[model samples]
Target: MMLEVAIKHAFGGFSLDAGFTAPSGVTALFGRSGSGKTTIINAVAGLLTPDEGRIASRGTVMLDTHHRINLKPHRRRIGYIFQEGRLFPHLSVRQNLGYGAWFAPTPAGRQDASRVVEMLAIGDLLDRRPGALSGGEKQRVAIGRALLSAPELVLADEPLAALDEERKAEILPYFERLRDEISVPILYVSHSASEVARLATTVVALEAGRVVAKGTAAEILGDPAILPAGAREAGAVLTAHVKTHHPDGLTELEAGGIALFLPTVHAAPGSRLRIRIAAHDVMLSRERPEGLSALNILPGTVHSVRPGDGPGALVALDTPAGRVLARITRRSAQTLALSSGATAHAIIKTVSVAASDVGAAAAT
Candidate 1:
C-alpha cells in the first residue's frame, strides 16, 4: 500500500469519518462539495490535524492520534498542489521550482531539475514570472515545483477546478504523464466524473463524509448505483488503440476485438488511449440494427439491470470492449425486454464521444 488513512473529525455541524488504502498510481477522492474530500487530503498533508486519526505513506507514520505521534507538515515530505498554482508572483518559474527543491531534507533527495522541466515542458517558461504565465502554464510549473521536492507522495486538491475548459485540456496531458512517468503515489481530489474516468487508476468515492465505494476506475465509473451524481455522470472507460484515421475525419480504434469509430482523435496510429462513454449516450437494441447513421456498434449480453426510483433504468453489459453501461427509460427497457443473460447491441454515435472525454492510457 502506498498510503493508509483512517480518520475522524467533526467541524461545526458536519462530521467526517473516512478511511481507505491508496495503492500505486493516482488515487482520486471523488465526491461533491462538503463530502470531506478536501478534509481527508488535508489530514494526509498535515494541513489539518484530525480530531483523532492515523495516516501513513510508504509505511512511514505521519500521524497517530492514539500514540500522539504527529509529524509536522514539512517533515511528512508531502508536496501539495492547490486549486490555483499558488506560485510566488515575484519569483520567476525557475526560482519558484527551486524553492521546493531547497526544502528537500538532504541534498541527495532533491530531484533533477532539468528532467522535471523537460517532463512538464516548462523549460521555455523558466524565465517568466507567474504573472506572465497562463493558467495552464502556471499549473504546469506548480506540478514541476512539487516534483522537485522529492516528496514521498503528492496531494492535488482539485488542481484543475480553477481552470477553464481549454486550460484544463492543456493541463490534463501533463497529469497523465505524471501518473505514467513518475514513481511517486498521488492522492487527487475531484468531483468531476469525466476527470475521474480520464485520470484515476483507483477511485475512493465519498458521500456525507463516508467512503461509499472503492475500486478501480472502470468499476466505480461504469456502475451507476454508487455514483453520487447518479446515472447522468455514470460511464465506462474503454482502453483502445488507434488503428486508422479515415478520410471522412473519423478515427478508428480497436478495443478488445471490437472496432469503435469516433471524431478525429489527435493521436498517432498504435497509440493506446482511454475513452469515456457516458451511459446516457448509449442506445440499446435487441438485434443489430441496420441502415443507421451511427458508426459504432458492439454485441454484448446484459449483465444486470437496475431500475431507478424514477422512470429510468441502468443496464450493464459484458461486451468485447470491456463493460458498457446504458441509461434508458424503464418503459423502453421493458418494451425491449432488457434483463440478465439477454443479448443486445450497444449502438453509439461517433460524434457523441466528446474530445475532452478521451485521454492517454497509462503505461502498464
Candidate 2:
C-alpha cells in the first residue's frame, strides 16, 4: 500500500506545509511534538481539511482539495489509535471491540474474533470493563478493536506516550507482533528514537512542518547527520540471527559473521533480531587489544570521520559485522590520527547493550 499526503494549513500562528509518501509496513512520522505530525495524520484521517493538495491510499483519493473531494472520517477506511485507548467506560472489552467492527461500513462478516483476541492476548480480559483493566491491557484492547474494524490502514499517534515505562515496555512486543502479523499497513507517529528504531520500516522525518528526510529505517536511522535522541541512542541498527542461548542467561547473535552477546530474549535460534550499540559505547583501537572486558571486537576500516553536532566527531567504520559509528572527542580523534580508510577495531562491552535499546532489525 502507498499512502500519499500533501497538505497546507495554518493554525495559531503556525504554518504547516507537509507532504510525504509511505509504502507498505510501518512508516513512522518522526519529529518533535509541534512539528505537525498530528496535523498530517488528521488530514489523512479526514479530521482536518487542508487548504490544498490531496490524500490518497492505495490509489483511492481520500481528500482532494483541487477536485473538491473529501471523505468523511467514517467513510474513509482508516483505523485511528490515539494516545489514550478511549474505551467507553460503560462498555466491556468485548463490547468496545465489537463497536469498532459494528461501525465499519463493510465488516469482515466472517468475524475473526478468536484470531484478533489471540493476536492481542485479550481473550482473558474480554469480559472486563475498561475501568477494570490496566493501562497496557486497555491499549491492547484498543488495538484489537482497531484491527477488528478491518480498516485498510492503521494510524497510530503516539500510542505509547501516555503509558509509564513498564507499561510501554509491556506493549512494545505486541506492537511488533501486530506489525509482523497484521495485513493492514501502519502509519505510526512517534518522537521516540527507540520506538522508531524497533518498529519502523520507513521513516519520514519532519522538521518545522516540512519533511526533512524520508527513507528506509537503516538508511535514515544509520545516518550520523540525523540527530538521534541522545548519545546512547546514536548508532546503527543491525539485523542479526539468534545463534543460541547461553547458560548464563545471554543470547549469542550472529551479524555479518560477527557474534554479539545480548540478554536472553524470547527469540529462538535462527530467529532474527535487531540490536543497537551506542556510538559512545564503542571504543576504537589501532590493533586488536588483549584481555579486554568488552566481549565483542569487530575488525573494520574507517569509512569516514566527520564533525558531529556537539563537541565530538562521528567516525563511520566499515566492519565485517556491518557499519558502526563511534562518537569520540575531537582531541582523541586527532591524537589517534584517525582518517577515512584507516584500519581499526571497535570494542563494545556485552552488558552495555540494554534490552530496551534493542529492536527487531527486520522491518515487516
Candidate 3:
C-alpha cells in the first residue's frame, strides 16, 4: 500500500502545510511535539478536514478538498489506535475485541479470535477487564481490536508513549511481529528516535509543520546532517546473518565476511538481522591498533568527509563489514591525513555499544 498526502490547515497559532508519501510496512510520521504530525493524521482520518489537499492510499481517495471527496471515518476502512488503549473498562477483553468487529461496515467475514490472541500472546488475558490488565496487555488488546476490524490501514499515534521503558520494550516485538506478519500497512507517529530505529520501514521527518526529509530508515538515519547529534550520531545499518553464539553471553554475526560480536541476541543462526552502529562509537586508525581491547576491527577506506558546523567532521567509510561512519575532531582528521579513497581501518569497541540501541528485529 502507498499513502500520498498533501494538506494545508491552521489551528490556533499553528499552520500545517505538509505532504509526503508512505510505502508499505510501517511508515513513521516522526517529528518533535507540535510539528503537525497529529494534524496531518487527523485530516486523513476525516476527523479534521484540511482547507485544501488530497489524501489517497492505494488509489482510494480518503480526502480531496478540490474534488469534494471525503469519506466518513467509519467508511474509510482505517483502524485507529490511540496512545491510550481506550478499551471499555466494563467489558471483557473478548467483548472489547468483538466490538471492533461490530463497527466494521461489512462483516470481517468471521473474526479470527484465536489467531489474534496467539499472535499478540494475549490468550491468558482474554477473560480479564481493561482495569485488571497491565499497560502492555491493554495495548495488545487494543492492537488486536484494531486488527480484527480488518483495516486496509492502521494509524497509531504515539501508541507506546504512555508506557514506561520496560513496558515499551515488552510491546515492541509484538509490533515487529505485526509488521512482519500482517498484510495491512501501518502509519505510526512517534517522536522517539529509538522507536523510529526499531519499527520504521520508511521515515517521513517533519520539523515545525514542514517536511524536512522522507525516505527509507537507513537513508534518513545515516545522514549526519539530519541526525539529532549531527555528525556524532550518524551511523550505518548493516544487514547480517547470525553465525553462532559464544558461551560468554555474546552472539557472533557475519556480514559480507566481516564478524561482529553483539551481546546475545534472540535470533537463531542464519537469521538475517539489521544492526545499527553509531558514528560516535567508531574510531579510525591508519594502521591496525595493537593491544586494544576493542573486539571488532575491520579493514575499510575513506569514502568521503563532510564538514560539520563546529569542530568535528562526518567521515564516511566503506568497510568490508558494510558502511561505517565516524565523527572525528578536525585536528585528528587532519593529523591522520584522512582523504577520500584513503585506505584505513575502522576500530569499533564492542563494549562501547549500548544494548538498547541494538535492534534485534526489523526497524522502520
Candidate 4:
C-alpha cells in the first residue's frame, strides 16, 4: 500500500471521519468544497493531527493514536505541491531548487538536480528568478523542488486551481509524465471530474467527510449517481490506441477492435490514449441509424438504466470499446423501450470528443 489513513477529527460544528488506502500510481481524493479533501491531506501531512487514527505509508508508520507515534512534518518525508508556487523572491530558480535538496535528511536517496531539471523541462529557466517566470513555469519549478527532496509521497491539493485554462493545459502533460515515470505515489485532491478522469488510476470519492465510492477510474467516472451534481456532464473513460491520421483532419483510435474517429490529434500513431465520451453528448437508437452526418456509431447492448430527479436518465451500454454512458430523456427511453440486455446503438459527434479528454496513454 502507498498510504493508509483512518482518522476521526473535528472543528467546532464540523466533524471528520474518513479512511482510505492509496495504491501505487495516483489516487484522487474527489469532492466538492467543504467535503474534507484538504482536511484528509493535512492529516497525512502532519499539519493536522487526528483525534484518533492510524496513518501509514509503505510499511512506515506515520501516525498512530494507540502507540502515540506522531512524526514531525519534516520527518514524515512527504512532498507538497501547493496551488500557488511559493518560491523565494531573491533566489534564482536553480538556487531555489537546490535549497530543497540541501535539506535532504537522507542524502543517499536525494535526486540529482540535473535529472530533476530535465524531467520538468526547466533547464532554460535555471538562471531566472521566480518573478520572471510564467505561472506554469513556476509550478513546474515547484514540482521539481519537491522531487529533489526524495519524499515518500506527494500531496497535491487542487494544484491546478490557481491556473487559467491555458496554463492548466500547458502543465497537464508534465503531471501525466510525473505520474507515469516517477515512483512516488500521488494523493491528488480535486473537484473537477475531468482532472480525475484523466490523471487518476484510482478514485476515492468523499461526501460529508466520508468516503461514498472507491474504485478504478473507469468504474468511478462512469457512475454519475455518486458524484455531487455531476450527472449532467458525467462520462466514461475508454482506453484507446491511435491508428492513423488522415488529411481530412481526422484521427482514428482503436479500443477492443472498435474504431473511433475524431478531430486530428498531434500524437504519433500507435500511442495509447484515453477518451471520455460524455453521457450528455451520446445519443441512443433502438436500431442502427443511417443517413446521419455523425461520424461515430457504436453498436452495443443496454446494460442498465438510471433515472434522475428531472427528465434525464442514464443509460449504460456494453460496447466493443468499453462501458459507455449515455444521457437521454426518460420519455425517449420509454418510447425506445431501453432496458437491461436490450440491443441499442450509441451515437456521438466527432466534434464532441475534446482534445483534453483524449490524452496519450504513455502520459497516463
Clashes of each: 0, 1, 3, 1
What overall lDDT, based on C-alpha atoms, would model 3 receive against the true structure?
Answer: 0.83
Sorted by lDDT (best first), the order is 1, 4, 2, 3
lDDT of 4 by residue, 45-116 (tens): 999988999999988999999999999998888989999989887999989999889767777889888888
- Give the clashing residue pairs of candidate 2, or none: 274-361
- Candidate 3 RMSD to the real structure: 2.5
In model 1, the number of clashes is 0
Descending-TM-score candidate ranking: 1, 4, 2, 3
Per-residue lDDT of candidate 1, residues 12-82 (tens digit):
89899999999778999998889999999989999899999999988899999999989999999988999
Q: Which model, 1 or 3, shows the larger TM-score? A: 1
* TM-score for all models, in order of appearance: 0.97, 0.94, 0.90, 0.96
Off by over 4 Å in 1: none
Candidate 3, which ten residues in sequence have the lowest lDDT sum? 224-233
Question: Using lDDT as the measure, which candidate wins?
Answer: 1
Candidate 2 residue lDDT tens string, 89-151: 999998999998886666545248798899888989989999999999999999988887888
For model 2, give the RMSD to the true fold: 1.9
Q: Each prediction's Cα RMSD?
A: 1.2, 1.9, 2.5, 1.6
Query: What's the lDDT for all of these models?
Result: 0.92, 0.84, 0.83, 0.87
